[model samples]
Target: MNPRRKKRLLFASVLIGGVAAIASLLLFALNSNLDLFFTPTEVVQGREETGLMPEVGQRIRVGGMVVEGSVDRDPNSLKIAFDIADSGPAITVLYDGMLPDLFREGQGIVAQGTLIEPHVLEASEVLAKHDENYMPPEIAEAMGESHNKMEYSKGSY
Candidate 1:
C-alpha cells in the first residue's frame, strides 16, 4: 500500500492487460482468416456425418489430381467445371475464371473455395501443378506418402 509500490503495481497490471488484449485481437484475426485443408474423401465423410450440407463456409483448400477427362468448359464463356480426385474420392469444382495455363486432366491441383453443395466446391481460386514433373508440395507429399493407402475406391474418372 505504499505510494511508489502502488504505481509500480498499476504499471505492471496495465502492461499485462495491454499485452493480453493485443494477443486476443491477433488470435481473433488469424482464426477468422484461417482456411482448413480437406481432401475429397474427408469432405464427403464430413457431409455424411453432419447429414446436412453447408456447414460454416470457412474457406477451405482441397488438393488432388484432376480426374482425367473431367474438365468441362462452355464454348462461349469462362465458366468451367472439373472433377478433382485423390485415391479416395472426387469432388466437382466449378470455376468461372480463366484457369491456370498448366491446368489439365490428370494434373495435381489445389482449389480454394466453399463447398456450396454436397460434394461440390464453388472455387474462387484454382492452382495447378507448375510443370510436367512438378506438383504442389502438399499434393506431392500426399501422393508420395499415401497413394496406395488412400485409394478408397477405383473407377472414378
Candidate 2:
C-alpha cells in the first residue's frame, strides 16, 4: 500500500481498464453494424410509438410503398418479389438484383436486408426513388399523415 502508492494505484487501474475496454469495444462495433429502419407499418404492426418489432434476423432498413400490385418477377433470373406499403401492414421484399430505375409499383422504396420473417424481407439493397420530389427522410418519418398529404400536394411544404 506504499510502494509509491502501489505504483500509483497500478497506473490508475490500468488506465481505468483501458478506457473500459475501449468503451465496450465501441459498443460492440456499433451494435454489430446496426441497420434498423423499419416501416411497412413498422414491419407488420409494431413500432407505432415504440412498439419496436424487427428481430427475425435483424439487419433491417425497410421504408415503404411499392405495394400497388406487389410486383413479383423471377423470369428465371434477377429474382424479385414485393409488397411494401406504409399506410399500414405489408412487407415481403425478397430481391436479388437490378431493380432501381426508379423501381415501380406505388414507388417509394428502401429495402436493405435480412429480417426473413415477421413479414419477410430478404433484400440486399433495393433503393428506388431518385426523382419526383425525393422522399426518404426515413420514408418521410415512416409515411406519417400520408407524408403530410404528399408534401402538401407537392408544393413541398
lDDT of each: 0.78, 0.82
Q: Write the per-residue lDDT of candidate 2 for residues 1-157, one digit (tens) a residue.
A: 6799999999999999999999999999999998988788777877768788887988888888786677989899999888888777787888888988878777788898998788898999988888767888877866768856644655631
RMSD of each: 5.1, 13.0
Error of 2 at 33 (Å): 3.1
Q: Name the runs in model 1 displaced over 4 angstroms.
A: 46-56, 144-157
- Candidate 2 to truth, TM: 0.39
In model 1, the worst 10-residue window by lDDT is 148-157
Q: How many backbone clashes can be found in candidate 2?
A: 1
Candidate 1 lDDT, 1-157, residue by residue in tens: 9999999999999999999999999999998787777767767765454453345455788899888789999999999999987767799999999899888787778899987886899999998867655666666665665543433334233
Candidate 1: C-alpha lDDT:
0.78
